[model samples]
Target: MHREISELIEIGRLLHSRGWLPASGGNLSVRLEDERVLITASGSHKGHLTREDFVVVNLKGEVLEGSKKPSAETELHLLVYRVFPEVKSVLHVHSINSTLISRMAQEDIRLEGYELLKAFEGIKTHETSISVPVLENSQDMEELSKRIEKKLREEKVYGFLLRSHGLYTWGKSIREAYIRLEAFEFLFECELRLMPLA
Candidate 1:
C-alpha cells in the first residue's frame, strides 16, 4: 500500500510539473483491493503529496484510515469503481485544455480521426471516434456521482468532463490512468487548435 501510494504521489508531481494540476486543483485514487482504496486527501497540493496525505477509503466511500480527510470528490471515484470493476485507478486533472474544451462543448466532446485516439485502450486505429461525456458542474459530490451513474447506464465512456471543471480518466492501473489522462489532454488540445479562427 505504501509503495502504491508513493508511486501515485510521484505521478501527481509529474502532472503538476506539466501544468495538468495546478495548486490544489485535482484529486487521484487507486483501488487497493475489493474494499480498500488509496486517495489523496482534500486541501493537499497534489504535487507536494506525502504518504500522510493519502487516506484509505472503503468501496462505500467511508474512510478506513489516515488522519487526513479524503477528497471531497471521493464519491466520483467510488462510482467509477462500482461501475467498472476492471478499473483500479482514477486520475482527475484541471488542465486548461480539458477545462476549456469541456466548457466549449455543449453535450459531448468527440475525438475522431486523430492518430492519438489510439492511445485509449481498445482502440487500434485512427479512424475510431470516442465521445467523451461532459456534465454540468456541481459542488455536490453525491449528486454529481448519481448523475455519472445514470450516464453509465446508457453509454460506454473512457472518461468524462465536468463543465468548466476538469477531466476524469480511469484505467486498470495508475500507469494506465495517467496515460489516458495524457491522451485526453492531447485530444483536447488538438480540438482546441482546430477551432475556426475568429
Candidate 2:
C-alpha cells in the first residue's frame, strides 16, 4: 500500500508540473488487489498531493478508506478496471492539445504514420495507425461509461478523449501509465502542429 501511495503522489506532482493536471483538473487511480483502488480525492491540487489526498474505493466506486472524498470520476477508473482486467493504473488529464483537438474533430482523431506510435504497448514500429475515439462530453457518468465501454469493444484503444474535456489513458503500472500519457500528449501536440491555420 505504501508503494502505491507514494507512487501516486509522485505521479500527481509530475503530471502537475508538466501542465497536464492543472488546478484540480485531473484524476488518477490504481487498482489494489481485486476489490479496492487508490484514487485521488476531489478538488485537490495534483502538484501538492500528499498521501492523505488519496482514498480507497471499491470496484463499485464505494469509499472504503481515507478521510478525503474520492474523485467523482472514480467510477470512470472503476469502469476501466471492470472492462480491462489487465489495467493497473488510470490517468486522466486536461491539456491544451486534448481540449483543442477534441473540439476540432467530430468523431475520432486519426493518428497515422507517426514514429511515436511505437511508444504504445505492442507496437514495434511507426507503420501502424491508431484512431482515438472522441466521445461527446456528458455530466452523466453512467452514460459516459456505457459509451466508452461500447467503443472499447471495437478497437485496440490506448486512451480516449472527451470532447472539450481531456484525455484518459491507462496502463499496467503507474510508470507505464505515465509514459502512455506522455505519448498521447506528444502526439496530440504534433497533430495540432500539422494542421493548417485558417
Candidate 3:
C-alpha cells in the first residue's frame, strides 16, 4: 500500500509537470486486495499529493479509511474496477489536447497507423486502429458511470475521453496506466496538429 501511494504521488508530480494535471484537475487510484481501492482525495492537487491525500474505499465507493472525502469521480473508478477485474490502476487527466480533441469529435476519435499506438497493450503494429469513445460530461456521476459502462460493454478500448472534460485510462499496473496516458496525450496532440492541414 505504501509503495502504491508513493508511485501515485510521483506519477502525479510527473503528470502535473507535463501540464496534464493542472489546478487539481485530475484523479488517480490503485486497486488493493479485498476489493478496496486507494484514491486521491477531493480538491487535492494531483501534483502535490501525499499519503495523507489518499483515501481507501470499497468497490462500492464507500469510504473504508482516511478522513478526507474521495474524489467526486470515485464512482467512475469503481465502475472501471468492476468492469475490468484485472485493472489495478486508473488515471484521469485534463489536458489541453484531450479537451480540444474530445470537443471536436462528435462520437469517437479514431487513431491508426501511428507508431505510438503500440504503446497500448495488445497492439503489435501501427497498422491497427483504435477508436476512443467520447462521452458527454455530467456532474451526476451515476449517469456518467452508467453511460461509460454501457459503452465499455460495446467497445474494448484502452482509454476514453469526456466531452470538453478529460481522459480516462487504466492498466494492470500503475506504470502501464501512466504509459497509456502518455501515449494517448501524444496521439491527441498529433491529431490536433494535423487537423488544420486536413
Best by lDDT: 3
Off by over 4 Å in 3: none
Distance from true location, Cα of 180 in model 2, Å:
0.7
Each prediction's whole-model lDDT (CA): 0.90, 0.90, 0.94
Tens digits of per-residue lDDT for model 1, 61-128: 88899999999999998899989999999999999999999878877888899998888888999988
Candidate 3, residue 4: lDDT: 93
The per-residue C-alpha lDDT of model 3 at residue 185 equals 92
Error of 1 at 140 (Å): 1.7
TM-score for each candidate, following the candidate numbering: 0.97, 0.97, 0.98
Residue 24 lDDT (model 3)? 85
Q: Write the per-residue lDDT of candidate 2 for residues 17-110, one digit (tens) a residue.
A: 8888888899988989967999999998899988889999999888889998888788888998899999999999998889899998867988
lDDT of 2: 0.90
